[model samples]
Target chain A: MSKRKLTIAVTGLNNTDNPGPGIPVIRGLRDSEEFEVRIIGLAYENLEPGIYMHDIVDKTYQIPYPSAGTEVLLARLEYINSIEKIDVLIPNFDAELNTFMRSADKLKKMGIRTFLPTLEQYEERHKSVLPEYGEKYDVRVPKSKAIFNASDIYSLNDDFTYPVMVKGKFYDAFIAYNTEQVKMHFNKISSKWGLPVIIQEFVKGVEVNVVALGDGKGNVVGAVPMRKQFITDKGKAWAGITLKDDKMLEQTQKIFSATKWRGGMELELIKTNDGKYYLIEINPRLPAWVYLAVGAGQNLPEALVKLALGEDVKPYENYQVGKLFIRYSYDLICDIAEFEQLSTFGEL
Target chain B: MNINRNIAISDTGFVFDPSSGDSYSLNPVGTEIIQLLKKQKTIEEIQVEIVSKYEVDDVQLEKDIIDFILTLEQYNLIENNE
Candidate 1:
């Protein structure tokens, strides 16, 4: 008997210096022996390298940016569906996931499936509300506060000290050594991403991350912990190696159980000198380094696709530890005509 | 304005600066402007050529070209003699 071929559409195709997880997720799907995949690459920019990587993307279409609202996005998806008929959609950007989550039911009615966390689950784990989340879940989180204006930085002396982490609501974070730097980052981030900027106590420790999938029923389908070996100036993991830490695995399971979280999530943790794990941020979607999880034996993206398709997927019990992933930039030669076509026609 | 001689730029807009070990990806318009800079074209000449080829007007092209050049200068991909 032959396995079925699936048409999966994925977003966040900007595989640049600061990459998205789409290419890595597609790689996981391509590596699956149980399913053959035809990938539809959804991109926001013409130069998203995945759009030109024909080996990975069967077709590429430019969608409206998330700021365009859900109506425009759904209309674009409808047109794409009329032509390609995508079976599943995996939106990989944090900025876009809210629109997807809100439109998930409409997408299902249009025959497009997605396995994503509920709106409540997504909201509760947001960076702004993470302090309360930690309290509710009994997790150790750094003291943090969300401020709407730069003037609030002056008042942070009560709960925070100098060298606190200044974070935007949606993206960007900087370690500020003084109030001036805090104001600078606050204005910079607020102007771009809008605020309530987050001020957090800087936890001195090694940074670690966990990529895990939940069954939405208090079960962790798969989990892998990795310590970043090399970090880029932008603070992305340039290289990472898996770790065999039972405590990390236990924490992942506990978070899943506590939140009943559905779909893929990345938990960023700071392990202090005293060996305590401090939850830093929770990304509702897979991280850019998810390919490392696939290499380590848990093909999470494949299992996620199956779960979205209403298939019963057994929870992965074990993965090979000590697998290393070193990310390198490759120059993909492409023609200007291809770029012109996609930029003009919004499809290639 | 002169492009850094050590910078290697592919047609696909992948830029590698050997001196800094930093790589960058650019859009088509950005790549075209960099190619023009590499050919030692004056800013006015580059703007005229781009405006004639692309769907942009001279005014918009002028502004865009200046912004692009400033970005290149910030990234240390170009040498500003001025």
Candidate 2:
């Protein structure tokens, strides 16, 4: 008997970050000859579809923005349902999480598996709750508070120092210094996003991103650490390298156990001069750049797919460490632009 | 914070930290900050130059410059200049 075709749909594939990490995860599944993959997003047309080498996607789907609570989402979801046997649904962008999470019941009724942490887990892992968890892992997460009204944020503890950052309950951040300054920023951001707002400690250090794969049984199957070699204007890490930091790995495992995390995740860590790495936030989905974990030899989406279908998951073994992958242009241009000071940024 | 170190970078934007065997790459502003620091510009001085070059504000620039210079120093990218 021929192998049954397993279909997966990835939302938010249109991000312009070059050599997108998602490609590798898709490739791992397609190349394994076990699954059929389809990438769903408006990426190549609406966004800069920078050169990519992953040829696994059987088809790419594009949908318009303002998707949630609107025709776009319904249309897209309808299109998705039209396609049979979409066993796994991976929501890639943070912005899309709200729609899918809010609409979870409906999707689950359709027999689609959501690749998110539980709702309760999401609440805890969000900006408001992660800091407390950060303390457990010795990760320096930004200090913040959750606010219902923008006015309440104004009269915060006057003892609060300068340079605090105000952010959404999720990923977006708006940096503010003084109270009055934050008030002005408050209006600007209020018009853009709805609260509860998170006020966090503005911790600074070299950003180190850790991507790990978790078996559905709550064990960290694989993990990789990469320092922020370069970041885009939108806070995307443009250029980075895979590292072999056992210390970071241990702390990551500690946090994973503490959170009872049971899926693929990305942790943003900051390294202080005192040789401490502080946790910033935890991402519950396979990040766009998840392929780095693949480059490092832990293919998450496939592992999760296998685990979800009740198949025996192969244990992840240690692989060659210290492998580096760079974007075709961003890392290169950023390097040429700053070559004069290469002595400092160049040291690795 | 002064970028009191000679930096070598790859065309692919790989920042090799010879001091700690660690490497970093810079975004556009990160690249600018490292350059101005290499010219021995003070944090405040570099902030002014950077603001004229990017959309970031003085408050952010101030904190970013100080924190970034410290980050460079922490990674042994540089320390106090003579």
Candidate 3:
């Protein structure tokens, strides 16, 4: 009788509020009865060592996260192999997407479901990559250039505008208000982070992000266009309002199709001073504001779980567009502390 | 660290003072830093003090204290005594 029910492994279960932006996915998975869920983590801070959260999980297992090269992901794969079976591998962090993307072929061979966007798709949505694609779509993106070296940056004079963005290939991003500032930032980051820096034109406007879940069959099932009011410590949008506009929703679909992307995606759109919508970057996974998507009406996690199990994907009723969500709780108090990481006594 | 006596709290995290139309989040660190700020420690003073006392680095400590106070000022947590 139990053989038919799916056993999904919810990895990175950090039993804390600072669990990046992935906590809501766990909550949504737990709320659904379709999947028999078990939580796997590196440690259980919520309980005594070797003891897991009995209330939230059917069973919990401890696997040490590896610090060495490929050890962490390998440890995760080994844990996956130990499981009865896996239906899906949901990456909870944008940083994890890189590793998860590389592991896609292996997971597919193992008969597990992993929804990773393609390299082209990733390039289509990345902040540095958006401007190039924006040209074809007639979508205005920040004036940008991908530099191969530090000298390429130093060669720039007053020809470039003030207040440009210094974007990293990975996580770290910064703003440079002048040539000296840009060079100073470049000097610091180029040595520390390695090469291929992106210098982008800065646009001043309201920052809006679009969250959408898509199936592999070229179908986008759930979506929300939102104006982010604040971002929490883990880069999660702490508070935002969903936009109620069919035009924005339609345009979002246009951008996805233009990119020929699959899986879940979020696009950061900057409305310029000229009333033009410029696609700044695309996050090929859930945004920090996904919980707000649930509040707005579409439960993307539930939809994603169903799709991963090889079940017939269902249509998602469009969620209310103008709903607002603000993350505030006893847990946030803890999350913000660890996140701010300010130099202060009693503030770590 | 002593907090300014007049800081008012709101349920939605909307902190304010009627004297000026300023707002802020006692966003955990903000809560802790405000306690320190009321002691009237300068930014560098707080950074040096925190690094010596806490389990953080010089760079991180400076960034955190400066950002925390800046956020405080943004939300009007630090007001004009004038």
Q: Candidate 3 residues A18-118, lDDT tens each?
A: 44444566566666655556543322223321123334444444333332335566555655556646667676556556666776777767766776677
Query: How many clashes does each candidate structure show, in the order listed?
Result: 0, 30, 3
Better of 1 and 3 by lDDT: 1
DockQ of each: 0.01, 0.05, 0.02
- Please provide TM-scores, in order, for all candidate models, with all chains considered together: 0.81, 0.67, 0.66
Model 1 bad stretches (over 4 Å): B1-82
Give the poorly placed runs of model 2, Cα more than 4 Å off: A1-4, A17-24, A31-56, A60-79, A98-111, A132-142, A152-157, A328-348, B1-82
lDDT measured at residue A215 in model 1 versus the true structure, 0 to 100: 87
Give the clashing residue pairs of candidate 3, or none: A342-B64, A343-B61, B23-B75
Residue lDDT tens for model 2, A13-127 = 4435433444545655665545655543223232323112234454444444544364556566666567644676666666666666766666666777665566666666777
CA-lDDT, candidates in order? 0.91, 0.63, 0.62
Per-residue accuracy of model 1 over A1-348 as CA lDDT, tens digit each: 687899999998888889999999999999998999999999998899999999999999999998999999999999999998899999999999999999999999999999999999999998999999999999999999999977788888888888899988778889999889999999998998887899989999889999999988989999999888789888899998787677889999999999999999999999876679999999999899999999999999999999899888899988766678999999999989998899889999
True-structure RMSD, every candidate:
18.1, 14.5, 15.8
| lDDT at B78, model 3 | 64
Top lDDT model: 1
DockQ of candidate 2 relative to the true structure: 0.05
